[model samples]
Target: MSTTVTQQPQHSTLGECKRWLRVSLYTIFLLTGQCTATLLGRFYFDKGGKSKWIATSVQSAGFPILIPLLFYSSKSTNHDSSKIKRKRSVMFTLYLGFGLMMIAMDFLYSCGLSYLPLSTFALVCATQLAFNGVATYFLNSQKFTALTLNAIVVLTMSVILIALNTESEDSKDLPKEKLLIGFFCALAASATFALHHSLLQLYFVKVAETGAFSALVRLNFYPMFIATVGGVVGLLGSGDWRSMGKEMKEFEYGRVSYVMTLVWTAATWQIACIGMLGLIFEVSSLFSVVVGNLELTIAPILGVFVFHDKIYGVKIVAFLLAIWGFLSYIYQHYLDDRMANQDKSDDGLQVSKGEEQI
Candidate 1:
C-alpha cells in the first residue's frame, strides 16, 4: 500500500511534467512558425507577388503536410468505432463551415497585409485577444473577469492609437483610402480569427471523441482541404491564375525565390496552425490566443530590422500598451492556475483527513 501511494505521486508528477513539456513545445512552434510565416508573407508582397487568392490558398493548401502525422497518430492509437460512427457526419459539416470561415478570414488577412506595412499589420493583429475574449464570452460562456476586461480595453486603445497616427512613416506613402481598407480588413480578420478559435473550442468540448492529437489533425486537414479548393476556384475565377507565371518571373529575386517564398510561407503557416490546434486541444482557445500574442510582440521588432520600418512614437506607445494588455491576460491565467492548485490541495487534505478518521 505504501509503495502504491508513493508510485501514485510519481505517476502524477510525471504526467504533469509531460503536459508542461507538450505545452512548451507547442508554444515554440506557434512563435517561430507564425513569426517566420508573417515575415515571408510580407516579403511576398514587398517583392512584387500579388494574387490575394494565392496568398489565402497557401495558408491552408499545406494541409497535405499534416497527412503523415495523421497517419502515424492513427496507427498508434485505437479509436472507439461507435463514437467515430456517431460523430463522423457531424464533424464533416462542422469542418465544412469552418473551412468557409477560414477562407473569408484568410482573404481578409491577405488584403490587410497587402496594403499595410508589416509592423502596422502585426500591431493590428494584436486585437485578436480582445476579439477572442468577446467571442468566447458569447460562444464558450467565458466569464469577463476584471483582468480580461482591462486587457480588452487596453488593446483597443492600442489600436486606436495606431489609427489616430495615420501620418506615421508607414502610411505616409500610401493613400488614405487604402490604409483605411487595410485597417478595417485587419480588424475584421482579427474578429473572424477569434470566432474561429471559439468555434473550434466548442467542437472540442462537445463533439471531439478522439485523442487530442488526432482531433487536431482532422480539424486542420479537412478544413484546409476545403479552403484550398475554394482558393483555387477563386484564383481561376478571378483570372489571377494566368498571371502566376509573369508574377514569378518579374519577382525581384527571380522565379526560384518567388516559388520558395510561397512554399515556405505555406509550410510555416501549417506548422503554426498545428501548434495552435494542439494548444486549443490541450488548453483553452483563449490560452492559445494569449501565447500567439507573443508573435505580435516579436513580429514588430523583426519588422523594424528586416523591412526597415520606421518606428514612430505613437507606434512605440501602442506597442507598449499591447504588451501591457497581454501581460494582464497572462497574470489572470497565473492566478487561475494558483487557485486550481489550491483547490486540488484542499481536496487531497480532505481525503487524507477522512482516511485518518476511518
Candidate 2:
C-alpha cells in the first residue's frame, strides 16, 4: 500500500549540500554498525553461541535513539498527537506486518551468520543492495536512470567477482548440506531485508508526516519491541532459556565476554540503524542500502586481519570494481542535482527577463 504526499522541493544548493553532509555523517554510522556486526558475527557464530534471542535483542540497539525521539514527540502540541494518532490508526496493520517481518529477518540473519563464513557472508550480503534497489524501483516508484543503472550493474559485477572463487572457512569441516542450507538461508535473509528497506520507504513517503526523528522512531521502535518479544517467547518456548548458561560457557571468551559481546553487538547495531534510517530519511532507501553495502568491501580486509581469511588478486580486483561502482553512483546523483539547479536558475532568469519586458 502506498500513500501520496505533495512534498516541497529543496531547490537551494545549500539544502543539497546540507543533505550530502548529513548523508555522509549517517554513512559513517552505518559503516560503524557494519564493522561491529561483522566482528560480532565472527565472535558469536564461529564460537557456536547462536542465540536467537540475542539476534532479536541486537535490534533493540535502536531503543536509546527512540528515547530522544519520544522526548521530541512529547514536546509537540496536542494537534501533533492527534495527527500522530490518525496516522498510527491507518498504519496499525503495516506496523504489525513489518514487526513480524523484522522478527523473521533477525532470525534469518542469525541463521545465515551461524552457517556461513564471514567472507562468504559479506559477499552474499552485497546482494541485499541489489534486492533493495529493485524493490525501491518498483514498490516505491523510485526511478533508476541510465547512469544509476550503470552504477548498479558495476556493483553487481563486483559481487560476482568477489564470489567467483569463494570458499567458506566454516564449511570445510561441516557437511555439504550445512553449506547449502547456509547459502540459501543467507540469500533469503538478504531478500527479506531488501523488502524491509523498501516498505519503510513506502511508509515514510505516504504516512510519516511528522519530523524525521519521529518517523525513524516509529520505524525502529515498534518493530524492535515486537522482535524483542518474539525472541523472548521463542527462547522460552524452545527451552533455549535453560541453555543460556551453557551457551555462555561455550563462548571462546568466558561468560563475562559473552555478556559483553551481546551488549556491544546490541549497541553497535543500534548505532548502525540510526545511520541507516538517517540516510534513508536524508536521501532514499536505495542510497542507504548502497552505502551500507560498503561493509562488504571493508569486511574482507577485516577478515584478513582478524580471522586470517585468505584473499586473492581476484578479490582485490573485485574490491576496486566495488569502489568504482560506488563512485559512479555518487557521481550520477551529483550530475542530477547540478542539472536540477541549472534548470531552476534558468527559470529564474527567464522570469526576471519577463519582468523587465513588462
Candidate 3:
C-alpha cells in the first residue's frame, strides 16, 4: 500500500479585520494625497506661468502612469477567472461617454476657476454630496433615509455660509456673466461627477468581478486619454501650441529638472489619490460618499493655514455642524452594522438548535 500525503490548510496572512483596517487607512491616505496634490497645484499656479494649463498638465502627467501600475498590482491579487465578454462597440461607447463627461467636467471646472475664487469653487463643489445621493438613489436603489436628508441640509447650509463669509482677494468687481458662467460650470461639474461615480460603480460590477486593479485601470484609461486629447486640443485652439512644445521639450530635457516638476509631481499624486478613491468606492457603502465629500471640510481648514486663506467664525461654525452631521451618519452606520452582526449570530444559533431538535 502506498502512503498518501495530506497538506495542512494555511492560515491567511491577514485577518478580515486587519484587512478592513488597512483599507480604511489606505482610503484616508488617498484623501490626504488628493489634498496634498491640490495644495501642490495651488503652489504651481502661484509660481507664475499659465496656472490653469499648469494644473491640468501636471495632474494628467502622473495619473496616466500611476493608474496602470496600481491596476496591475490589483490584478495580480484577484482570484476571479471570469472574462468580460461585452462587445467592443458597447464597451467603447460606455468608455467614451464617461470620458467625454469627465472631459467636459475638467474643461468647465478649469474655465470656472478662471472666474471664481478658490473658496467659491470649494463651496460649490461640496454640493457633490447631494448629487451623489440623488444618483445613488436613482441608480443603485439605495433608500434615502431621514439621516441622509438631514446630513444634506446641514452640509448645504455649511457650504452656503462658508461661501457668503469667504473673503475676496480682489476688491474690484468681477464680470456678471463670467460669475454666472463659473457658478453654473461648477454645478455642472458636480452633476457630472455624480454620474461618473454611479457609472463607475455599475462598470465595476459588470466588467470586473474583482475591481482591485482592472477596475482602476479601465476607469482611468479612457478618462486620461480624453483629458490628454482635451489638453492638446485646448493648447492648439488657444494658439499657444508653443507652450505645448515648450512643456514637451522641458520633459525631454529632463522632466524632473524642468520647471514643470511641481506639476508632474502633483499629477502623480492626483492619479494615486483618485485610484485610491475608486478602490474605496468599490468596496464601501453609501457612507463613502459622505466621507469623500468631507474632503471639502478638510481641505478648506488646512488651506486657511497653509495658503494664507481666510475663513470667518460663522463658516467655521458651519463646518463644525457639517462635521457633526457626518459623525452622526457614521454612528448610524456603526449601529446598523452591530445590529446586523447580532442578527447573523442569532440566526446561526437558531439553525444549530433546529438541527439538534432534528
In model 2, pairs of residues that clash are: none
| lDDT for model 1 | 0.82
Over 4 Å off in model 3, which ranges?
1-16, 51-54, 67-71, 74-90, 167-172, 211-213, 244-265, 268-286
What's the lDDT for residue 291 in model 2? 77
Candidate 2 at residue 11, lDDT?
A: 38
Error of 3 at 349 (Å): 2.9
Query: Taking the tens digit of each residue's C-alpha lDDT, what string does model 2 give over 1-358?
Result: 0111111133376688887898888889998887887687567766767666666556664466567666776466234667666766677777788778877887777776667765576667778988998899899888788877777777777776666557543344567788778788889989998998888788788777777776676677776777777777777887877878888988887889887877788778877887888887877888887777766766666777887878788778877887888888888888877898778766666666677688
Cα lDDT listed for each candidate: 0.82, 0.74, 0.63
How accurate locally is residue 189 in candidate 3, as Cα lDDT from 0 to 100?
84
Which of the two, 2 or 3, has more TM-score? 2
CA RMSD of all predictions: 3.0, 5.4, 6.1
